[model samples]
Target: MTIATLPAYPPKPRPGDRVAVVSPSAGLPEVFPRPYELGLERLRRDFGVEVVEYPTTRKMAAPEERARDLNAAFGDPSVKAVISSIGGDDQITVLPYLDRELIRAHPKPFFGMSDNTNLLAYLWSTGIVGYHGGAVMTEFGRPGAMHPLTEASLRAALFTHGEHELRPADTYRDVDRDWADPAAFAGEPPMEPGSGWTWRNADRVAEGVSWGGNVEILSWLLMADREIAPDPSVYDGCVLFLETSEDMPSALDVFGILRAMGERGLLQRFSALLWGRPKAWSLESPNSAQEKVRYANDQRAAVLRAVEAYVPSIPVVLDVDFGHTDPQLVIPYGGRIRVDGPAGRVTVTY
Candidate 1:
């Protein structure tokens, strides 16, 4: 299907406005209450937004129930925004049950990332812009405190309009802590110095509505032939931003997926590409610091390998501080994004 017009940016919520917290994915709040509770406190205290929780926000529910809560949140006039508690593995199932017309009619800014990408894409198809970052359980519910950059970006996305410039975080981290342990709440996670962004073929500027999210989730969408446009020109001139999750697919797997996208003519459709900093460390694969560096490098290499075979001349930026990283920046999915390769800057319209 061809998207005839750009997606509309929903009205931003104010500090004291009510926002619905829903669990469209895994109900991690039920299993790990500490972080979830902390996140809620932060949302109320730090952000000063009144949070309304759905019935399935803390507990696992069937896809239909999740969809019902999402529809209710959107349909309510009092609720100014909707945010996910945390990302999970099966939000795609919830998509089939979503009332697209209801959500499209009651347009409000929606915030989520990782597996929540499914909803982002769905919202795009419905012609509403959605945020590609921030979650109550992760960003707002951070341990000691929220990262300064993250807070600033999210605050701007939530309450402000117009262009907000994107900058590289001075430091970043991907190592996860035991959310179940009380001791983990004592301080912030350890972070190392950042390497900044790596730009490739950045001789020109690319500006358009941003698209894409967690690469793994996008791969699933592609496999299901769900939200992607049948006509490649539908994405022409748009900025493509992608990031990986904690699952951390191998570099080869990353390349394989992008290769598949390239084969589908999706790669060449974008004006530029923004690669979020890969989450290098996870409990399942605890690599040494040196190993983590090597892993990231390999992933970047794989990305370039795919770019070379497809959209070789397009501008690409790597290691951007979004996705599953310490200090995440909110990208306005389906909203305007200006990537100035010459100036090494990125600005998003919220």
Candidate 2:
């Protein structure tokens, strides 16, 4: 979309403001109360925001019920912001039930990622910018203390306005512990030294409004013909950011999705691209550290392959700390992003 037609950035919430916790995706909090409670405590203690939960915040209710809670949260003037407990696989099912007119009338800063990309994309279509990180169960309720980088980025996204620079994390963790086990909450997850960000075609600077989210979710959205504009050029001059979930789809799958987007004439419209670090390990696929590195390399290669086919010269930064990786940074959907390849810096206007 052109700058004149870009979505409006919702007002940021203050520390004392009340924020709604809803389950637009999955009610993971019900299955894992310890982490959910911990996340709530941190939201109140660390962030100083009062927590207001909806009916389906902890229960795996029907799609309409989840959508009702979402509408209630946004329609309630007392709620200044809304956050998801966690993301799930079938958030796309919840979209048809949402009251877009209600949400558009009462816009609130919404925070989530993964399956919540459905909501982020919905909000974007409704002319409101939504955050793509800071899910309660994962980031806010992180085992032990929250990651400093994550907290800083979340804080800026929640309370401040204007530009916020994003820095590469020196360390990150992808291996997840069993949230069902109390031991998992005993301390922070183990992390390894990070290789920093990989920049491609970064010889110049590019700035534009940002778009995109979890790659898998975007593919689903495309398949469903959901929130994406019919005109591929709506994303022209936009900064596209994408990440993978814990499902760990093969590199072939990643390339296939991007190839489809390129075939649709959607991939070439962006001025820059930011790829979130892929989660190389999961419970089902507990890859070795070496295997993790190889998986990441393959994923990166798949992305580069697609980039070569479309928008090859655009600035591309990979392995950004977002999505399923530990210490995730909040990326503002439908907000301003400046990608400076020559300066080796990336900044997002919160």
Candidate 3:
């Protein structure tokens, strides 16, 4: 088995161009009209882009319906890019119904994360590069204002085409506010001071094609074998990055997933693993400030335990801003990235 073919970056949209806003996953927009509308308004006012929503963009719909919206969005020449409304648990359900050939024939930039990872990996298999962050509802429609890091990273991904260096965010927010409350939009949510990334295992540079996504989502895909190739070699020499969602998998669960990947000869294929800054807190399972730090520490320890057992020499960077954290960075789904451990820096070619 060999590394799968690298995907071509689809056409980028220009200012004032049209972009598709589809909900291939859960349509949270219907329930959270404030955030959804704010996100759309930002696209128009801040980005100077017009959004065209499909029928499934705002409410619950069948998998077939979502797939059709995806196909319609990608196939339309007028739609320069496609962005998700939000991620949901059941996006994997739409995979079987996707028109792969149609998507391949008309490549367009697709932006999403979390369960949207399902679609990103699917696009990767089809040799079409999709973005791994910047869902409309979260980043664009962020209360008060967008995080500087997120806004910068997203702008670069959307408008530029070249090597872009990624830096550690000076601060981050892992807590999610109540989106249902109108007051949540009145001011910026509280944020705590953050330390930058922690590095281990090596002091040399590692560069390769990129792979991996939400660890939980990947687990679901592994069981279904939806977009993953039969050959484990497709991930060879890739710079793998994985993150956790707010549901908050236990440390044991994290190690178990990695161990499973290792058993499949997939874990050791990566040159390095970028462990995204885990969402240590969620509304459903809110922890005290001290507990939040403790949770993050335990998660890191679990990751180290898995790596030491599976790929001991692999350079691993912790607390990268690319997951369910405030000020997320948009990593290219199947793009190239360089991790210079010696300099403690990571750069991605957009």
> After aligning candidate 1 to the native by TM-score, how far in Å is the CA of 155 from where it should be?
0.2
Report the candidate with higher lDDT, 2 versus 3.
2
Q: Per-residue lDDT for 160-246 in model 3, tens only?
A: 798999999888899888999999999987887878999996588899888889999999999888788788777788999999999
- Tens digits of per-residue lDDT for model 2, 1-350: 22236788998889999999998999989999988999999999989999999889989899999999999999999999999999999999999988888998899999999999999999988899999999999999999889999999999999999999999999999999999999999987898898899999989999998899999999999999999898777888999999999999899999999999999999999999999999999999999979998999999999999999988999999999978998899999999999999899999999
Tell me the deviation in Å of residue 118 in model 2.
Answer: 0.4
Superposed by TM-score, candidate 2 places the C-alpha of residue 228 at a distance from the truth, in angstroms, of: 0.9
Total residue pair clashes for candidate 2: 1
Least lDDT summed over 10 consecutive residues: which range in candidate 3? Answer: 1-10
- Superposed model 1: Cα runs more than 4 Å off: none
In the range 1-350, model 1's lDDT, one tens digit per residue, is 35656799999899899999999998889999998898899889988999999899989999999999999999999999998999999999999899888998999999999999999999998899999889987898888889999999999999999999999999998998888778988897888999999999889999998899999999999999988888878799999999998998999999999999999999999999999999999988998989998999999999999999999999999999989998999999999999899999999998
TM of each candidate vs. truth? 0.98, 0.98, 0.98
List per-prediction Cα lDDT, in the order shown: 0.92, 0.93, 0.91
RMSD of each: 0.9, 1.4, 1.3
Task: Between candidates 1 and 3, name the one with more favorable lDDT.
Answer: 1
